[model samples]
Target chain A: MKKLSLAEHSVRELNSALHDPQAMDGGTEWYVSDPDGRHALACGLNDELQVTIDGHAGYYCAGMNQHATVVVNGTVGVGVAENMMSGLVRVRGNASQSAGATGHGGLLVIEGNASARCGISMKGIDIVVGGDVGHMSAFMGQAGRLVVCGDAGEAFGDSIYEARLYVRGQVESLGADCIEKPMRDEHREELRGLLAHAGMDFDPSEFRRYGSARELYNFHVDNAGIEQGDSHE
Target chain B: MCGIVGLYLKDPSLEPRLGELFEPMLLAMADRGPDSAGFAIYGDEVPSDQLKFTLQSAEPGYDWEGLVTAMERDLGGQLDWFRNATAVVIKTDSGEERVREWLAGNAPAVSLMSVGHSIEILKGVGHPRLVADRFSLSGMQGSHIIGHTRMATESAVSMEGSHPFTTGLDLCLVHNGSLSNHNRLRLELERQGMTFETENDSEVAAAYLTWKLREGETLTQALESAIQDLDGFYTFTIGTRDGFAVLRDPIACKPAVLAETDAYVAMASEYRALARLPGISGARVWEPEPGRVYVWENAQQASEETGT
Candidate 1:
């Protein structure tokens, strides 16, 4: 595995040098150093590359990526893997807002808490946050799977379209049009698979599922009775 | 795809710090819209009651100077100075709308916009430094400023299309997202005898809000009306002479994030954009509710002054 240290180079230089396939012989590994907490360290990559940042990073660290498996050993800034088409991004520490935003396809796993608007407007990304998520998580989410192991803040999944939210811990409340659905046998298996993908050991049965009931999507005068939704037992 | 930023403060204590905080925020958004940038800084003068008109005209051949001189003679103000290719800061002893009307009649060819305690606008095409140099942005002392960098997707690439556009006295708008119902609104405003300079949706929004506000409606009412009336993806950071307001479309098609500290209130299209500004470490940041409009007045202004 080849190791590429990003400490010495600017983001633009590092990206330009890494864009060529010949420079990266099969399956390259880069160990970034002296990161000094720079933003957009490894953004806009589509190569089959394995890049790791040694320290914390600023916003959109691996945004709009494809066919890359990027890892941040420390905290990550906002929009991690934003609009990523495919591949994987793992953050060992907390992530900021709009993580995996508008991603068409990808597996984003954050080991720590995520800030507000996490996975917002997410299209087809599968995000697994190990810790609590801030308010408005998955707001206006179109299509994706967001699994939160810890507590979720208020207004989760507001105006959400088709994304599925699975929370193993407490949820403050669900946003408009979002409802808690029973974790039936099929959902349990699905959760188990997603958890395994993120290398999580949590039991699937312990988690609850939340989704849009499709009730508020089509507005009705009588629908006023359906205010907010909760998923705690 | 560049950045836009604004600052409005009533406390004179924070006035000097406005440029210091705003410069970095504008730098952060360089990647979003790097083409051209400018800012309209508004300031309150000590014991002052004067209407200031900062007008930017097209290239010199358009006869804007003659019109400005006539309007200045008519409105009873002196032309402070002319800078670069466009900006002319004028001071008038007359009322705000009176100056506006005089400028409208005399400078029919010039696209006039304003910001601050009275009204001022600074804009040009190119990088921030390029536009800043053209307008001498750093020297303007104001209580607040609203700025924009153009990506030119929906609007023509010209000085008139730049942001911080004014609809009436002391009102300006800097927008990040596109307005869906801009065409309909523009036609409606034009029918009401309002002139539009550019095809950009943001201009229509500026005109719409200004028209609504001038008609005795509050900022909140104009925003609520925008939510009910405006269509498509948009997020606007609007600054008036008195305060600033932010509004997102009901669906929130565009992105906008806000952070508020006890000392200051800041907002931007992205969190990364705001991170570049000072005093963000302890600030509590969050996305505004979709379909909701949030208005933040100058920290020193009363709640009633917000006109929300």
Candidate 2:
């Protein structure tokens, strides 16, 4: 067990200390204080360490993480746990835009709302937001599971591909190529596991599943007007 | 990349220190926008019967004195003036159309930054710090303020290209991202008799909002309509005499953060800009949801609203 105050050491110093395998010889449990919404804190930790951030943090706080379990007690700014390969990152408070953006592997959970672009371009990550997830979430997602306990914003999961989206509340609008799918036995079982891992108590049967329609995966030249946005291609 | 910061104080005790609190928030995003920067502060309310006009000139050494004297003589009205670095605030008991027409017909060399009872806009090219210092922004006072640092993704890097564009009577808008269909929207707005001040994409948005308000749309309705009407990546923070608001495009690619305490509500491009605010640690901070209109109005004005 260890304790480091961000007031005494810069975020870089604390991260470097966490990165050094020898420096963490006493134990893998470290507590960080006075984060005060600074960027890149507790990022890129690979070992099976437990990192507890005492306060708010800024962009990419637990980015590119693997194996480590990081907890933020307060709100987090943009791109929290961005591009994580594997790990568990938890925010006890709300998360800003693009939470867990483009992460390949990991589980990121927010106890409060997540703003726009939550889980965007996620290759393989399970994201659970206790509150609403904002618009354009899961945009162009390749593969993953995004579970929302509250409303999902406009154009949720636009231009999607092979990712699963589950929402318990209303969805403002679904993006192109993303369509609501029936939550079957397999999806319920998988969602049950995800909710359990995130320590959320919601019933899997309460949610509805959404995923790619697979219509745009192999576009036929004959099918015109598929790209229907105002922008000219 | 661009940076936007807004401060709306619910606690009157903090009004006098608006500039000192807002200076760092603007400069923190210096890297986000290197081309130009600007801000609109709601301060120095004129007499209720009077109109205030913030006037500026392209030439630094332009004879503001001679022009003011001549205008006073010609308009046959007493005009009190306060000169800051970026522009001059002129308070006069004059009609809005008459003043604008007078300025247009007489003082073509002078440009109007804003025309309201209590707003002053100051902006210029360079670092936010330099711009703030040049205008002595840290010494001003107001109920609310909104600022922008531009990266010049579209228009040329001139003062007109800078943000916190003022279009309506006392309203101003600062943007974070570029609009994709501004050309078409601009044309449509121009045909409706809304004039433009610059080729900047953001100006079109400002004009659009002003036009909507003129057409009897409430501020909330105008912002909601923006999400449907405008196409592009954008997050707009609009400032009015008694209110301030935040809105984003449906697919909110632009970044914005908000924090609120008993004393104030603050918004910025990132949390770091808001980190230094007083009593922020205990404030309720959250990311503003996309396609939602978040507005903070003066209590008196808010209570005056008749219906939803």
TM-score of chain B of 1: 0.83
Q: Candidate 1 chain B: worst 10 consecutive residues by lDDT?
A: B299-308
lDDT by residue for model 2 (B154-222), tens = 888888789889887899999999998999999999999998988889999999999999999888778
Looking at candidate 2 chain B, the ten consecutive residues that score lowest on lDDT are B299-308
Ten-residue segment with the worst summed lDDT in candidate 1 chain A?
A224-233
- In each prediction, how many residue pairs overlap at the backbone (N, C-alpha, C within less than 3 A)? 10, 0
lDDT of each: 0.74, 0.87
Q: Which digits, one per residue and each the tens of the lDDT, describe model 1 over residues A186-223?
A: 98998899899998889998899998877763555555
Off by over 4 Å in 2: A1-11, A139-144, A154-165, A171-190, A209-233, B58-62, B97-107, B300-308
Report per-prediction Cα RMSD to one decimal: 8.8, 5.2
Candidate 2 local lDDT, residue A172: 84
lDDT of 1 by residue, B1-308 (tens): 54666666545666677777677666666677877676777774412665566666666565556765677667564444354457666665666667667766766666666633455677777777677666655555667677777787787777777776777767788887777688888999998878777788888888888878877888878887777777777778877766777776654556666667666667776665565545555565555655566776656432222211
For model 2 the TM-score comes to: 0.88
